[model samples]
Structures are given as C-alpha cells and as structure tokens.
Target chain A: MKVMVAGGAGFIGSHLIDALLAQGDDVVCVDNFFIGTRENIAHLHGNPHFKFYEQDLTDLDRMLKIFQAEQVEYVFHLAANSDIQASAQNPMIEYKNTYSTTFILLECMRLCGVKKLFFASTSAVYGEQMGVEVSEDAVALKPISYYGGAKLGSEGIISSFAYMNDMSVLVFRFPNVIGPRLTHGVIFDFVKRLKADPTHLRILGDGTQSKPYIYVMDLVDAIMRFKDVEKGITLYNVGVETQTSVTRIAEIVCEKMGLPEIPFEYTGGRGGWKGDVPVFAYNLDKIHAAGWRASMTSDEAVAKTVEMVL
Target chain B: MKVMVAGGAGFIGSHLIDALLAQGDDVVCVDNFFIGTRENIAHLHGNPHFKFYEQDLTDLDRMLKIFQAEQVEYVFHLAANSDIQASAQNPMIEYKNTYSTTFILLECMRLCGVKKLFFASTSAVYGEQMGVEVSEDAVALKPISYYGGAKLGSEGIISSFAYMNDMSVLVFRFPNVIGPRLTHGVIFDFVKRLKADPTHLRILGDGTQSKPYIYVMDLVDAIMRFKDVEKGITLYNVGVETQTSVTRIAEIVCEKMGLPEIPFEYTGGRGGWKGDVPVFAYNLDKIHAAGWRASMTSDEAVAKTVEMVL
Candidate 1:
C-alpha cells in the first residue's frame, strides 16, 4: 500500500515513518520543516520504500499533484502547529496551518480518489475535562486554545467529508505523547531548563495540572493495530488509564538526571498559560476494545523521554 | 448602549436592528452586502439612532477601527454565507465569509475592549440529527456544510475568548429562520420557483426531511427577552418546538399564493443538496426557562414567510 504521512518528519510522524517502512509499505514523507526537523528522518534517507517531499500539505495544488502521482491509498495526516501557547496568542497561524491544511488535504484526497485517512487529533479538543475520564463518543469538543479549535475544526471537516464522499476516517484523540525525538511540551521544557540550571527547576502552572501520556512507540503501534474499520468515522482515544502531575513529573526528571531534590518554582495558575487546559483524562475503552492498550504509565513515559532527551 | 450589528442588512440582522433602534439604542450597522442588501436597511435612512457601514467585518483593522470609533458596547455578529449548497460547492468562499470573518471579529473585539457580543449560531451546527430533538447544551455540533463547520468553529472561539478575556457572549443556535425580507431557504426557493412556473413546483429533496422554523420577529423578540444573562457563554436554541416537512412547506407556499394543486416533483433523497442536513429539532428548554417562547409554530412561520415573499 502507498501511504503518505503529512507531517512525517516531525516527532511522532518520523517515528511513524520508521514503523511504516519496517512493515514494507511504500511511504512518502511530506513536511515543510516548519517545526518538523530534517534530522529526525535523516536516517531513513536511503531506504528503498521511503520517499520524501519538502512541501506544505496546505498548498492545495502541490498536494493534489502529489496525491495524483502517488495514487495514495491512505493518508496519515499529522501535520499541524502544536504550539498551544503561540496559537492562543495569534490564532490565525494555527487556523491557516492546521485547519486549512486539513481542508486542503481533504479536498485533494477527494479529487485524487483517496478513500482512507488517519487523522492525528489531540486531547486538547476535550479541553477542561475537569480530570474526568472522557469517552470518544461523549466529547463535547470545546477546544480552549486556538490549536485545539483548529484540530476540532479539522475533525468536523474530515467527518463531513468522509460521510459525503464515501471515505473511511480513523481519528485518534491522543493525550500528551512522549518519547524520542521530543521537541516541545513540558518534558522537553523541563529537560532543557534543568540542563541550564541543575540546582533549581521552574515549572509553569501550579504543580497540580495533570494528564495521561502515551509512549510514542506505543502510539505508533496503536495506529498500526487498527485496520479495515468499516465505519464512516471511527474515533478512538489513544491514551493510558493513569496520569502524573507536574510535581511528580519534576521529581522523575530530577531522579532520571541523577540530581538531588531541587526547589521548584511554579508560575501559578490552574493552567500553564491562557487557553491551556489544566487537566484531561481520556476513557480508552474504545481503543482497548480494539485490542490496543497503553504499555507504560505517564510517569514511565516522562522519565524515559527525559533520559532520551538528555 | 452603543451597539454594532454585523450583517445588519440581512433578514434577521435587520429585524434585530429595528428592535434595538425602537428601544433607543445607538446602533451602527455593518455589512458587505454579499447576501445582504441595501434595501433591507433603507427604511432606517432617516433614523438618527441608526448608522450603516458598507464594509466587510472580516477586515481586522477595519473592525477594530469601527469598534473603537463607535465605542461599541455590544456586538451582534450575524454575518455569514447562508447558502449551504454553495458552501459545499466552494467551501473556500464560505470559509472566508463565515469562518474567517468570525475569527477577525473576535480578535478585534478582544483587542478593542468590546466585552459583550450576541452571536448567531445555527441548527446546522448539530448537523444531521435524523429528526432527534437536539438541545443547545446537548449539541454534539457536527456541522455538515462549510457554513456549519464555520459556525461551530466560531462558537468554540467565542467560548474560549469569553473565558480568556473576561467577555460576555450570548450564542443562539437557530433553526430555519423564516419571515419578512426573507432572502433564502425552502420557502423563498419555493416561492421563486412557483413564480417562474405557476403550473408546477419542483422540490429539491424527497420532501420527507423536516425541521423547525422560527418567525423572524419571534426570533428577534427572543434575543431581546434574554437581557440579563450573567456569566461567560450563555447559549440557547431559538426555534419553534415543532418542525414542518418540505412537502408541507410546498403545500403552504401554493396555498398562500392562491395557486391550484401544482405538481410537486422532488429532486430526490434525504437532503436538498450536498451538505444539506436531512433533519433538525432543537430543544428550547433553556430558552423557555428564560421566559421566551416561539409564538408561531413551524407551519405558521412557513406560511407567513411564503405570503411575505409573494
């Protein structure tokens, strides 16, 4: 099968490309390197089944050309602006990059005769869940940040398109995915801050904000596990049952880095920043029913990610 | 209070403007005349309390300027592409007109210090309900058309903006709003078609699709009645309790026009066109609790709208 990973050179996308290539599927990695780095996919340069395109998926004409030429049977759309803080500051960027990208990709796919799509969604779409175990079907989908709004917008568009065009869509609402090739989020931020000043750590938000985290490899594996879904819109929450708080994560990072107990300074609030959802917990019953479960807890994922970044 | 009504030259907006003016509010009406017209507000030319600006609100700078210069205390955002069929055909136009316009308006509101807003949402935000009674609070909000997606997107942004910026917002999810100066919908379509060919009337769908309708004046009154809403985001389902079928609507149009039994031909299927919702029924419990109700039923609204159009 010919598959195109829209953000295939980014953190999770690059890892997904590796897994897809290992399974002997012909893969086309498309990325503009906006936040996606070239270094992440550099190791797969000479792989026979792997191809790369330095193009923005939001560019409709180019996307159309690529889809037509490749005859892409499945699209793994993961490209988006992940910076929630930046999006809250200026939402237009997120709208154009994330929402418009999905719009253009769906249009291109419809025209190019692609019938299947794997949409990478975020837990932020269920913003301010108040720490409840939110199920996939029961999501109110009120994204607090512009990033989450854009993703939710993309999901609506995808669902509509799938229903109208006789296409199959697999949507995975992910929690904080942590592992190798980590570029952003709390884990990377803590690791970088601690590297600069080992005696003390500065944490955003009151150390109370907490949520589940899925290992990157486990996330990729969950995607691989779902196949031949006969529904128009098959949605799943790909997250573990347990969560770790900011303070607990700080402790783990300090322990992983072989440092003594350090005084922690917090930027006090329920949320780290404006539009930041303080807490989120997903009901993974849907994904678990499909025979995929989180292998590691949030603590283990954060610790391993810290170690990998170091 | 000094107020700004975007899309003030459109049907519902114009009605809203009259109510505001009659109540002695200094009103500034803004519209691009896309689907709106000068004739809708021509009656207000001599009224000193009413001011009209023929400018698109999607222009961020222009919107900010208008907000600042007018010292606009309240904004009624009603501007949008009302054509769902046209939206599905060319979503880009709808995105710019409906979705992008909302984004710009909210940004301008946040920056210009406008704290209160009345947003016109829709039953389409609930998408295809399959004739289920959908309440405002229980809305899953899956808009089928680009127009619906845009409105749902606006709702998310408005809610987030209200939370982040300490603004007050009232969102009303309206059904097929019908009555005087009606520019579009099934009533207007039937009237126009029968006018062109009085011997026969052609319906778009299988004619079994049904949804509620609210008379324009009743809708305007509902907005006026909900005056002292306290909190961030106050939403309501503003439509009649019962729904009228397409076939029933056609018969009403013919009856109003005093025409003979016209041969009714259905173009066929659940929806009138691509991106058309088959069924919609909004639960008005919240609105009823607020001491407002739809005086006219769906059939009455349709017949009155047909008469008005004729």
Candidate 2:
C-alpha cells in the first residue's frame, strides 16, 4: 500500500515515515518545513520506496496535483501549526495553516477519490475539563486556544467529509508526545533553557501542572496498529495511563543534563500562558480496548526525550 | 444597549432586529444581501434607532471599522450561508460565507473589546444522532454536511474566543426555524414548487423524515430572554419538543395554497439530499431549566410557516 504523510518531515512525522518505510509500504512525505526541519528526514535521501515533496498543504491546486500524480491510497494528515502559544498570539496562523490545510486536503482527497485518512488530533480540544478523566465520547470539546479551536474545526470538517464522500477516517486525539527529533514542547524548552544557563531554570507555570506524555515511537506504533480500520470516523485517545508533573519533568531534565543542583524559578500561574490548558488527563480506555498501549510511562518518555535532546 | 445584528436583513435576523428595536435598543444592522433581501428590512428605513449597513461580514477591515464606528456593545451573529444544499454542491460557499464570517466577526469583537456575542448555531451540528434526543451538552458533534461543519467550527471558535478574551458568549443550537420571511427550508421549497405546478407536489425524502420546527418569533423571544447572560459560554437547544414530518409539511403547504388534493411525489430515500440529515430530536431540558420555552409546537410552526409563505 502507498501512503502520504502530510507533515512527514517534523518530529513525529519523521518517525512515522521511518516506521512506514521499514514495513515496506511506499511512503510519500510532504512538508513545507514551517515547523518541520529538513534534518529530520535527511537520512532517507536515497531510499527506493520513500518520496518527498516540500509543498504547503494549504495550496489546494498544488495538493490536488500531488494527489492526482501519486494516486495516493491513504493520507496521514498530521500537518498543523504545532505551536499553541505562537498561535495564541497570531490566530491567522492557526486559521491558515491548521484549519485551512485540513479543508484543502479533504477537498483534494474527495476530488482524487481517496477513501481513507489518518488524522492527528490533539487533546487540547478538551479544554479545561478540570478534575476528571476526559474520554473520547464524553466531554464537550471546548478548546481554550486558537490552535485547539483549529484542530477541533479540522475534526468536524473531516467527520463531515468522511460521511458525505463514503470515506473512512481514523482520528486519534493525542496527549503530549515525547521522544527523539523533538522540535517543541516543555521538554525541548527546558533542554534549550538549561543548555543556555545551567545555573538557573525558568519554568513557565507553577510546578504542579501535570499531564501524560506518550513516546513518539509508541504513538507511531498505535497509528500503524490501526492502519487498516475501514470505518466511518473512528476516534480514540492515545496515551499512557500515568501522568508526570512539571516539577517531575524539571527534576528529570536536571538529572539527565547532570545539573542536579540547578535552581528552579517559576512564572507563577495555574496555566503557563494565556491560552494554555493548565492540566488535563486522557481516558485511554478506547485505545487500550483496541489492545494497543504505550510502551513507556510519562516519566519514562520524558526521561528518554531529555537524553535524546541532551 | 447598542447591539449589532449581523445578517440582520435575513429571515431570523429581521425578526430579531424587530424585537430589539421594539425593546428600545439601538440596532446597527449589517448584511451583504447574499440571501438577505431589502424587503425584509424595508420598514426600518425611517426608524432612527435602527441603522442598516450593506456590507459583507467576511471583510475584516470593514467589520473592524463598523465596530469602531457603531461601538457595537453586543453582537448577534446570525450571518451564514442559509442554503445547506447549495453549500453541499460548493463547499467553499460555507467556508467563505459561514465559517470565515464568524472568524472575522470574532476577531473584530476581540480587537474592539465588544465582549458579548450571541452566535446562531444549528441542530445540523448534531448530525445524524439516530433514535435519541440530543441535548446541547452531550453527544460528540460529528456534522455530516459542509454547512453543519462550518457552524460547528464557528461554535468551537466562539467558545475559545470567549474563554481566551474573557468574553461572554451565548450559543443557541436551533432546530428547523419557521415563519415570516422564510427564505429557505422544506416549507419554502414546497410552497415555491406548488406555485410553479399546482397539480403536483414533489418532496425530497421518503416523507417520513421528521424534526422539530421552532417559530421565528418564539426563537427571537428566546434569544431576547437570554441576551444579558453574563456567564462565560452559555449554550442552549432552542426548539419545540414536537416534530413535523416532511409529508405533513407538504400537505400543510398544499392546503394553505388552496390545492389540498395535490399529488405528493417523494424522491424516495431517508434523506432529501446527499448531506441531508433525515431525522433528529432536540432535548429542550437545558433551555427549559433556564426558564425559557417555545410557545409553538412543530406542527403548528410548520402550518403557520406554510400560511406565511403562501
């Protein structure tokens, strides 16, 4: 089978591409490198089954040409404006990159007769659910940030398109994913900050912000495990059961960086930024019921990510 | 209070404007006249309390200028592509008229600090939830039409904007709304078709497709009752509990037009159109709990709409 990864040069996308190539599936990687880096997919330069396109998914005509040319059977739509805080400052970024990209891709897919899709959604859609495990089916998805809103918008569009066009869509609502080729996150931020000033670390929020962090490979494996789901709009929450705190992450990063005695200073608040979701926990019952579980815990994933970045 | 009613010359918007003007509020009406007509708001030309601007809500700069000039204290965002079937034919119609309008309006509101908003959402956002009364709170919103998807997207964006900018938003998920100045829907379609050929009436679905139809005045009343809600994101299912069938609607239209013995021909399917939702029921528990109710039932609303249109 042939597949196209929409954001297949960035952190998780690159990892997904490698896994697909290893499994002997023809892979087409498309990325404009807005948040994605060329270095991530640098190792796959001369592979036989791997093709790459540095193109923006928001351009409908270009995406249509690619879809027509490749005869792409399936699409892994992981493309989005990944930076939540950056989107909070300039909402047009999320509207154009995140929401419009999904709109254009769905239109292109419909036009080209593609019938299957794998969408990477974020748990940010379940905004500020405070003090309960958010399941896939329950809880009204009221995203606090522009980024979350855009993702939720994309999900609605994808759902409608799937139903209207007789297409099958697999939407995975992911928590914070951590591992190698880490571009952005609290882990990456901490690593960069500590590298600059090992004596003091400035954390964004009050150290109590806690959430689950799934490993990149584990997430990729979960996506691979459910690749052949020929259902109409199958949604799942993919993450480990356990959670790690901000303070715990700080401690792990310090230990991993060999700077155990670094002083920690916090810009005090419940949330790190204006649109930040202070805390959330995913109810992974749906994905777990599917017989797929993350191999690493939140702490374990954070620790390994720290080592990889360091 | 000074309020701006977007799409103020359309069906429900005209009714809302009349209500607002009757209650001694300064009304600034903005519309591009896409589906809206001059006849709807012709009576308001000499009224000093009501001001009309023929402009598109999708233009950000113009909307911002209007916001600054009118000092619009609250916004009743009713602007959208009212024709769902037309949107199914061209998805970009909803993208530009429905979804982008909301995005631009919210941004203008945010910039001008005009916090309060009353967004007109729909039951289409609920999609095909078979055999159960869908409340405003429960059920994952998987809209099956481009129109529904755009409305749901607007809801998500409005929720986030309300949360992020400390604004109060009142989102009403309306069922089929009927009565005077009815631009589109089954009743309007039946009346128009029967006028063209009084001997025969053509219905879209199996004629068994049923859903609640709220009267426009009653819906306007509900919106007025909750206009001052200072809460963060107050959502309500605004509709009558009773449902009217498509065949029943056709019969009503024929009777009103003095052609009661007209032959009924159905296109024969669960849905009238490809993205059409066959059946849905709204749980009015939330709106009832908030001390509001629709005065007219579905059958009465449909019958009355037939009379009005004829």
| lDDT against the true structure, each candidate | 0.83, 0.89
Which digits, one per residue and each the tens of the lDDT, describe model 1 over residues B175-204? 888888887777878888988889998888
Q: List, residue by residue over B1-310, the lDDT tens digit for candidate 2.
A: 9999999999999999999999999999999999999999999999999999999998889888999999989999999998989888778888888988998998998889888999999999989988878987776988999999989988888878888899988889998788899888778778778778888988887999888889999999999999787758988889998999899888777777888787899889899888888889889888898788889889998888777677
Best prediction by TM-score: 2
- Which stretches in model 2 have alpha-carbon errors above 4 Å? none
Candidate 1 chain A lowest-lDDT run of ten: A136-145
| Whole-model lDDT, model 1 | 0.83
lDDT of 1 by residue, A1-310 (tens): 8899999999989998888888889998899998899999999989889999999877888888888888879999889988777777777777678877788888888787789899999887776866477887664666677777778777877767776678888889898888998788888788889999898999988999887878999999988888456758888889888888998888888888887678999989887888877777778887788678888988888888888888
Using lDDT as the measure, the top candidate is: 2
RMSD (Cα, Å) of model 1: 2.1
Tens digits of per-residue lDDT for model 2, A109-140: 88888999999999988888988799988768
- In model 1, which runs have C-alpha deviations exceeding 4 angstroms? none
Candidate 1, which CAPRI tier?
acceptable
Worst 10 residues of 1 chain B by lDDT: B135-144
